[model samples]
Every structure is written in structure tokens, then in C-alpha cells.
Target: MRIRAKQLAFAATAAVALLAVSLPASADVSGRAVKIGVMYPLTGKGATWGKHAQIGIRLAVEEVNAAGGIGGVPIKLVEYDYQAKESEGITIINKLATRDNVLAVLGPCFSSVCEVIFPLLERLQTPVISYCSAKPGLSKLSDWAFRNSLTSDKQLAPVVSRWAKDYSIKKVVIIHDLEDAVSKAEGSKVLPMLFKREGIEVLDILTFRTEDTDYSAQITKIKSLNPDGVGLGSCYQNAAGIIKEARRQGLSQPFVGGACTGAPALIELGGKATEGTYVSTAAWMDDPADAIQAFVGKIKARNGNKAFPYSAPRGYDSLLITANCMNDNGITNEKGDLASDREKIKKCWANVKNYPGVSGSTTMNEVGDGAGGNRVLKVVDGKYVDISG
Candidate 1:
């Protein structure tokens, strides 16, 4: 009897030891905090995008931490200002991945910055979700890179079709930013392709550098063409300047622009001149959905009633998506499991589908760009009205 009891005791001890060995090395929330990296061009020309993104990300982090964080571990954001410089972006990304040891990163907002940063993701082995880098197919540079924002091509296709039909635009003069990657692509590639599909003739293609403040020469040339409409491949600031110049030049052609011109800044800067201009956006600020209304209300309250840009919602969604991945994928935030945890987050990000967000339903396509509904907005009385029906 005594020998049998000893053997049973030994077996029980062995079973417990094996269980301990098989278990994960850390508890469910082992780390002091779950670190995530934020990279944005906070001080350069792209400061507007970075500011709005910061608001959204801050709100998301606050909400997550308020709700007991990810499995009771608070999220800590390691932030860096890339200043819209490719070299700065590259350095920031490396530091985020190695020095900070963050599980994932958000932003590096401009496509120019993202173009340089994304190619390094494979070697860094960190996942990055861009909030507003809308240059098409940029995310394809690395499997570790993902975008929560739609590319300019996707956002503009429907809007261009609608703009053509509504304005009876049989011909268009394409004006795009020469130096910016996204603006160049939108004007050179996306607009041409889309216009061709819509049976619109490209009357002329004009270009200007992003730093050019005076667009009178381009506007004069566009006026001479007298096309039925003008297609703009430019950001909000430049697009507004171009449109204002066209108006001043007495060019009455309806103007339509790509994703980058959809921000409130376009209307604010262009004012009455922006009226009747059409642009495509990933998010509609006037959405009647309860969640959207609440988000807008909070943003307005926080931003002193300034118009909220689409980057806000995209940034908010990016963080929430990252948090969801960390929670659902058994992330322990442990020092030893950092590599595996990052991989898990990357896999989760790739499979993101139909996530209902304030920015509409978000699904990460095979190319790593977001797939979601877009809003074709027309500037009316100083407001962007959704005419995408």
C-alpha cells in the first residue's frame, strides 16, 4: 500500500511539471505595458494629417485604457515625428522595431514617407499600419506593412465616374503634383485610367511642384484647353490653391480631385471657390450612423469645433484593430515572446475583414490596402456633402 501511494504521488508531481513546461512562459498580461509605436509627420508640410491622426489615436488609446486595457495591461505609445522626411521615417521605423520593441506601429502618414519605410519592414520584422498613406500598391512592398486607408485609385474611381456624368464632362485637363508620389500617381496613372473607362478625353496633363504657391500658369493653360472639367491629382492645400486660381482666371469648369483633396482644409482654404468641386473620401463626416455621430461629436469637442479630417477615423480604427489583434491572438506582451507576438499581430492584420468602423467597413485586401466604401463628396455652401448615392 505504501509503495502504491508513493508511485501515485510521483505521477501527480510529474503531470504538474509537464503542464508548467507546456504553458506559455508568461501570464496573460505579463508586461508592465503593451508598447505600440506611432510615427507621423508632426512638424512638416504634412502636419495637418499628423495632428488629426494624433487626436484619433489618443482617443482610441484613452478608450482602450479606460476599458481595462488589453487583458488588463495598459498600452504605452512610443511616438516619433518623422517630419515627412524619408530618411527620418526610415530611422524612426528602425528605432520603433528594435529600440522600443513595440508590438506594432501606426502611421508615417504621407505616401512619400511610407514608400521609404515600408520596404524596410521585411528586415525589421515589425508590422506597420498606415492611417493615410494612399499611394496605390505601396503596401505590397512588404508583407509586414498594411494600410487602414484606401488607395487613391479605389477612392477616386467611383467619384470620377459620378463627376463625369453629373457635369457632362467629355474632356478633362489633368493637373497633378510633380513631386509628391501619390499626387503624381493620381494625376498620371489613376486619373488617366479612370477617365479612359468613362469615355472622357484627356485634353492635357499639367504638373507643378508641391512647393509652388502660384498656380496661375497652370490655371491659364487649363483655361486655354477649355475642357469640360479639371481633374486634380493633388493634396488639399495645392488642390484648393489650383481651384482658387482657376476661379480667379475665370475658368468655370467643374473640378474634381483624388483622395488627398477630400479634407476639410480644401473647402476652408478655397471657400466659395471650392463650391461645386467634387472629391472622394474614405469617410463621410455627415454619416447618420450613431457611432459616426458620436465620433464626430467627440472630435468636435476636442478639436474646438474644427472640421474633423478622415485621418481621424482611420487612425482610430488602426489602433482598435491593433488592440483587437493583441487581445484575440494571446499576446502576453512578454519580453521573450516579442517576436512571436509581432508575427501573430501581423497575421491577424492580414486577415482583417469587414471590421465595422466609423470610417465604414474595413477589410484588408490581399495587397495590404484597405477595402471599404468611399464617399463622393461635393463642396456645397462650405461643407462636404455626400453625393455618392
Candidate 2:
């Protein structure tokens, strides 16, 4: 009887251990909501990009949740508005990392803000993916940082070549925003280098502050140079203003700009002046791909049938990619798994190859920037037409 009792106790212990081993696998799938951080400039100069990004991210989260979310655990986005200020951005990132305890962050959408915040990712042990911060080589600042948008240099090269060839541009005058990091890099560095490579002489380089509404002085200088074309290293608002000012001053030379100037707002603001302007962009909204058309339809439905910037699609793609990493890596989203889950997601993002996003086929290059082909778009009659083909 004693021996039989000993055997019964041993069998009960074995059964309990087996149940414990199996419970965790099921528990992980049924864990608490997964948390993701969304940081964007909702109110200041970068509001347009941020607002559109919010739409995209919201749509993505909705779809993911409706489809049962990450392993049946709903995703909760911890959102914050950085207001396009560098100081605000720093504070928000710190809060997200230390207090909110989100798994990954989506954006803080200005290149300048990104420049300051990316270096902190490694220390925080968090991964950041920017939707549209296109300063060249900013991702190289931290292994934890990645960009879904193309760098200014990568985006400008092909478009510059196309613009130079089509317009027979021999000499160019560059105008850039002095206060904006991406604009400064695009105007003072990327554009000049691209123009030289295309054998187009850079006659002069002019500058303007981000807040400067009047560009008469710069336009006056550009008119004096009489270059075959004008190169712009400015965002949509400033670029539109400069183009309009140039037209007002009777300078009709064609204008070409990098990624920052490619938003639909430029065409809306510049009106007739924006016609014939060439710009580089990561996504072409008019693409006839079935997936792209569906995305546009959804966006239009949500946005009162208005056209959206490249940032929208890029934002949508960022969320999907983050979700994919979580799903594929068996991320538990449990409090105990937060650190490991963050590292796993970071490693997964680092190896993303040919992710067929709504924007394009995105692959993370060695420097942590997305490598997808860019489009050289020409403004015609009030809309961007893909002329890269």
C-alpha cells in the first residue's frame, strides 16, 4: 500500500508539471493588449504629415484588431503629439520609453526631431521607426532606429537625373531652408552633389528660414543667376511659397525639389506656379495597382475623398510591419516579456526584406534606411503625374 501511494504521488506531480509547461504557450496568446507607441507632430509646422499619419495608423490598428489582432490580443496605441518641436520630441520619447512602456514607436515626423530622438533609442532599449524623416543617413545614429522613408540622397539622385535630362538643364541655382535639417542637407549637400554628377553647373545657392513667408530676396538672386533650372531643398509650404514668388517675379525656369517638396499641399498652394515642377516621392498615389487603389479608396472614405501625401501610405506600412514582427516572433506582450519582445522586434525589423507595403517593396538597407524605388513626379494642371517611366 505504501509503494502504491508513492507511485500515485509521483504520477500526480508529473501531470501537474505537464500542465504548467503547456499553459504558457496558451497564456502568451491570451495575454494582455499589446502596446505600441505612436509619436507625431500633431500641431505645429509638421501638422499635415502628422494628421495624415494618424489616419493611416488608426486604420491599420482597426484592421489588425478586427482581424483578431496579434495572436488574439488587441493592440493598444499609446499616442502622443510632439508638436514638431525638438524639445517636445525629446520629452515625449523619454516618456514613452520610461513611463508608457510601449513595445515600439512609430514616429516623431520631422528630420530635426528624428535627429535628436534617434540617439536615445539605444539607451532606452526601444525601437523607433519613422514614417517620413528623410534626412540622409540619420538612421545610422542607432541600431535601434529604422526609417520607412527613403533618405534625401537616395530619393534625389534619380529624380535629379531625370529632371536634368528632360529640361536640358545646364546650370541650376539651389534654394533651401536654412533652419530645417533635411532641407539644409538637401540644398547644401545632396542637390549640389547630384547636380555636379549630372554635369549641371550649380550657379548659386540661396537660403531661407522655415518661417520666412517672403522669398523676394532669394527669388531676386535666382532671377539674376538665370540658371536653366532651380533646385529646391524646402518643405511643401515653403517650396510652394518660393515657387509662387518666383513666378510672380517672372522667373519661369523649371523647379526641381527633393522628397520634402513632394506633398500634394505644394500643388494646392503653388497653383499654376507648381506646374512643370519635378519632385521625388516614395509613393505615387495615382498608381493603378489593385492594392494601391484599395488603399486610396479607404483613405478617401475616411478623409472626405481628398488626396493624401506619401506619408499616409508610409504610416500604414509602418504599423503593419511592426505587427508582423510581433506576430512572427512569438511576442508575448506580457510585462515580463517587454524587454525581450522589444529586442526581438528590433532584430526582426533589421532583417525586413521585400516587404510589399502599400507604398512600395521596402527592404531595410545596411544603414537602416528603406530601399524602395522612388518616383519622379511632375506637376501637371494641378496634380502630380508619375513621369519616372
Candidate 3:
């Protein structure tokens, strides 16, 4: 989730116009719908998790609306699909800030997309709550940018340390996607750094691009080296392909994946081959806890009993959190001033104490990133069994 951005100054004027519309003199609690825009890659390569996030956002807004909304104002969710494209995300952000003019935005879940849009939000003055994007330094891009999901550091530390210690693993091979921000951070930076800290040897590092389906060449290379373990920093499908190919090529060492592979699709795509794979992730939808079970039941029921991606619950929690923050920080639908209301929302998010959400109790640090821990789940017979100590 650590996407770098190209310069995007051309759209600055539109952000100014959007901000201008919401600058009024006073706050009034009008019984109006508190409109918030929801953006995600509803249709694309990673659309499975993106759609899951969309469903989670929809479920949350529907539930809140049925409960008579926040402080009597209906919480309306406006949906948009960026198709996992940064350009598309920028366009949608502009629309949400100007034409739709929503009070807040719930995200494009990829940090690459966020990197492109976050800078624009500092002036647009609309807060964006990304449920799954976990770029470590992204929150500093704007005061309005917030994440409810775990960062790569928080999400991968436990997985690396546990596997390294428990397995007494020395040399490891890392296969990750170079083009994706999330994979690059985990595969290239975070995991290697952790390995060095633990005095583990990084046998070899390999790279692939997003949308690359075949990993036979990389697997063949891995089979030759015969490392004790392998780590994947790619998204679920890519990770699945790597794991499947590695197993087929007779490399039986256990596999570990960064949080990007935590979605249900990994299990589905890799089947029996995924059984021993360890993943460090945030969402625990299958946790036996009653609260998680209830939330999972609600979403599964809505989506025809199909399992929603792990991202779904995090997205759900982010929206509810922002809404609750707005209400708690004196953000009235009556605040005719968009500027003042945005400031209050930003401050509330920055100073958020312990927000008990499905992702864990999140507290924002001074840098605006959430404070949370990772759960290491090893796939056992198609289920993610927690093995964290």
C-alpha cells in the first residue's frame, strides 16, 4: 500500500471550487442526509476485494440509515468505481468534492490510488477513510487522509518474527510484485529489513508485475535454491499462482504472505496448496468471537451467503468510525461551513483514542496512521487458523 505519486497540480483549481461551496458562516443541524462518497475498484483485476469493500460500506450505511442516522440526519453513501486506476480515482475524487460535494469519502483501497488523490484532499477539505490501503507514510500526505487498516509494518512484523523463530528459518526467498505499492513495500523493504534484524539470510529476491499470472520460471528458480521458506508480497491471485507453481515444482517448504494475500480468494485460488501458507492480516471475519460472527453473518446473508473478502469488514469499520467521529466532534449536518466541518472531522480523526472496530481497537498516532497489531493465520484445510502467540 505504498504507492508513489506523479505530480498532479493540474486539478488544483477544481478542488478550490469544491471547497468554496462549503464555506458558510454557521452550523445548523438540518434534518438532511449526511452524504458521503464511497470509491473503490468495483470492477478490475483486484475487484473481488474492492467489491467486498463496497458491500461492507453499503451494509454499514444501510444499517445506520435504518437507525435514523447520525443525530437524526440520514447517512447517504454515494458509490463510484475507479477500476483500480489512479487517473480514475482522481476524477472520482474531484466529482465527490465538487459535484456530489459529499461531507466525507470512503476510499479507493489501494495505496497507489490514494497517493494520487490524497494530496488533492488537503485543499478539497473532505476526509477520506481508506479501509485497506496500508502505506506507512501516506497519512502525512494530507490531514484529511485516514486509514483503519494495518500498515505493512504492523501487519508483517508478527508473521516474519513468528515464522523465523518457530521454524528456525535461516535462508528465505521472497517473490513480490514490483509494480504494486503494497507488494513492493512488503517484499522489497519491510520483510527484508525484518529478516536482517533477526539475523536471517535472504536467499534471493525476485520480482513480477501486476497481472502476471505465470510464475513457473520463478518457481523453477526457487526449486533449485531450495530455501527453507518463501514469502509473497503480491496480491492474492499472484500469490496463489506462485504458491501453486512452487508446490507443483516439488518445493514443499512452507509459504508466508504479506497482508495483501489475506483475502479469501487466495484460499479459493490455491486450494489444497494454500493449507500451510501463513498470512499476516487485519480482518478476522471467521473469528469465533460473537461480534465478528454476527458481522460476518450480516454481510454473507446480504451477498447470497458468499464469503466477503477480508477487506469488507475493515471498510465497514472505517465508514462507521468516520461517521461516529463526525457526530462526536460536533459536526452537524447543519454546519453550513464545509471548511469548519472538515477541520473538526480531521481533528477528531487525528485525536481518536481507542476506536473499537473489527480490525481491532485503532488509535491514530501523531502521523495519522492507525495503531494496530497483525494476526498471523496459517491456512489449515481451507481455513485460516490463528497461530499468533
Candidate 4:
């Protein structure tokens, strides 16, 4: 009888051990930090642009963490530098999706890079929030791709049309760089057509190569036409140079365009020449909203009152919207489970409407583009001031 009792106790102990081994470890699965994948052009032409975005991302992370984190688990941000390469951007997105298993990705400022990697994101059905690509065709890219960045057509065309119609600016010169993807794809064609529709006459249109820095020959030709206004589809660096040279050569006749004209670098390079320059974008830092003002204050304090660049708000708004979507959807920290949880986040994204962000109330449309209003800023006294109506 004693031996039989001992055998029964041993059997019971073995069963308990087996049960414990079969259960998943609670600590490993729960209370782990959620991981978010970030890809950006951290080098090459987009280095400064990526740095500004990272700042906004960090601000968003800080705000989320302060609010008890998502589902009581803190977020861990994983980043990769795409280096202005389309292939690199695609590779990073794929790695984040399949290997690192990020919940979502936000990055790639240039349209060319985003355009290349978008198909993969569609195949994986991963939610992506791009900051500054602003390509019009992105609306039809996929249901999974979301643009926190402003679409160029929606943001700039209306403002240009209104200004042209109001000023009765009949003869206009549209100058664009041939090699610029955004310029070639959108600016070169759309702006001219929009102007024509507004009853403005397109005076002799000219093309400049992005590689060529000298604008004297082009400026002289534009001056010969005596155009009422000049529309430039230039990068910020080139835009400033053009403005500076145009002013020096007395060719300025209410120049505008280049969505980045409001950038601090433009003001820095162009000096007084950037004054009265008009450009439209997703949102300006000088927004009237309390949250936006507070964010601007933070940036100002950090930068020691040096003006925050135009691209800074793009990053700030992207990260803010991402966190807002995650929090609204009841997503918690699931660092190791991002791949499985991506669908849940995508479903949550559909319901995210009019979420107040630093940029504005970003109301995500059916196309996954943030259909927010655009603000037209005039460079006044080296600062961006919103134009009336």
C-alpha cells in the first residue's frame, strides 16, 4: 500500500510539470513594448529632411509614453535609413514587414522612393504613412498606403488659381527642372493646365535642368517676356538660388511656387528676396490651434528662436496621427506580434476621422489620404504668414 501511494504522488507531480510546460510564458507575450518601423532618407539629399521627421516622431513617442503608453505597454521605435534610394526603401519596408515585424511604417520623403516601395506595402497590406511625397496617383496606389503629406494638386492648384484669377495675372511663366520627378510628374503639367483653366495665359514656358545651378540665361529669357508672375517647380535649394538671382537681375514680378519656398533654408539663402514668396502646403507651423502652437513653441525653444523649417511639421503631424490612430483603436504593446497585429491597426485606421493633430484635424478619407485643408503662407519679414482667404 505504501509503494502504491508513492507511485501515485510521483504521477501527479509529473502531470503538473507537463501542464506548466505547455502554457505560453505570460511575461514573454505580455507587457512587452510595441515596435513601430520607421524608414526615411537619412542620408544623401534628404538628410536634413529625415532629421526633422525624426524629431516629430520622438515628440509623438514622448506624448504616447506620457499617456500611459498604448495598452499600458511602451512603444519601441525601430528605424532604417533608406538613403534616398528606391530599392533601399523597398528592402527596408520588406524587412520591417517580414523580419522585424513592425506594427506600421512611416517614412520616405521623396515621391520616387514611396512610389517604388508602395506595391510591396500593398502586397503585405501594411499601413504606411508618408510625410512629403504628395504624389496625386498615390490615391490609387493601394488601400494600405496613407499619405499624411499634402497632395500637390489639392494643396497648390486651388491657391494658385485663386491668386491668378484674383490678380488677373494673364501672362505667366512656368519654369520647372526637367530632372525633378515631382516637377516632371505634377508641377510641369498640372500647374499650367490649372492656370489655363483659370483664364490665365501661359507665356513662354521654359525648362531648366536640376543639375544646372546657373539661372541667368533662363531669367533673361523670362524677363524678355515680361510675365506678370513666375511659377517655379524647383527644389528649395534651387528655388532660393533662383529667387536670389532673379532679384539681383531685377526679374522679380511676384514669383511663387515650389512647395518648399517657406522653408527656413530658403529664407536664409534668399534673405530679403524670399519676402512676398507664396507657396501652399499641408500645414504651416504657425497654425492657430492650441496644440500646433504649443508644438511650435517647443520647437522654437529647442532651436533657440531660430525659425523651424517647413518640413518639421510634416514629421510632427505624421507621428501625431500614427499615435492617435493606435490609441483610438485600443492597440497595446505587442512588440513581437506586429506582423499579426497589422490588420487590426489597418481596420482601426478606417475609423480614424478628424483626429486633431498638430497639422490640423486629419480626417482620413476612403483613399487613405489625409483630406485636410491647405494653408497659403506668404514670406513676410522672413517669417511665414498665412494669406487671407
lDDT at position 388, candidate 4: 46
Name the runs in model 4 displaced over 4 angstroms.
Answer: 1-31, 165-167, 328-337
Candidate with more favorable, higher lDDT: 1 or 3 = 1
Of candidates 3 and 1, the better by TM-score: 1
Per-residue lDDT of candidate 1, residues 1-389 (tens digit): 11111111112112223222322322387778899999977786657778889998988888777756776777899999988788899899999999999999999788988888888999999999999899998998999999999899888999999999999999999999987889999999999999999999999999998888999988988888889999999888898899999989898889998877888888888899999999988888787766778888878888888997789989987887777677666788889999999998898889887776777778888988898888888998889888888
Candidate 3 lDDT, 1-389, residue by residue in tens: 11011111112112122112222211344656788899888787578878888878887777655544655567788889899888899999999988887888888788889889999986788888888887678888988898877788788888888888777889999998987787888888888988898788899999998988888999998888888898888888888888999888888898888867887789989999988888877867667776677777878887788866667887877776666555555566654666677777677677766655665667778777878776788888887888986
Candidates sorted on lDDT, descending:
2, 1, 3, 4
Q: Order the candidates by TM-score, highest first — what do you get?
A: 2, 1, 3, 4
lDDT of the candidates, in the order given: 0.84, 0.84, 0.76, 0.67
Clash count list over all predictions = 0, 0, 3, 0
Error of 3 at 79 (Å): 0.9
lDDT by residue for model 2 over 18-91, one digit each (tens)? 22232233235545678899998788775778889999888888877765677667789999999888999899
Query: What is candidate 4's lDDT per residue for 1-389, written digit by digit as tens?
Result: 11111111112112223222322212233456767788877776536567677776776676656655554556688998898777798889899887877778887777777788877776876888787777677646777787776677777776687567545688888888776566655457777777778778888778877567899988888888998888877667778878888888897687677554445667777789888777776766766666667777766765667665545676766665555445444454456456556766666555556554566556667777767788776778987777847
Q: Which candidate has the highest lDDT of all?
A: 2
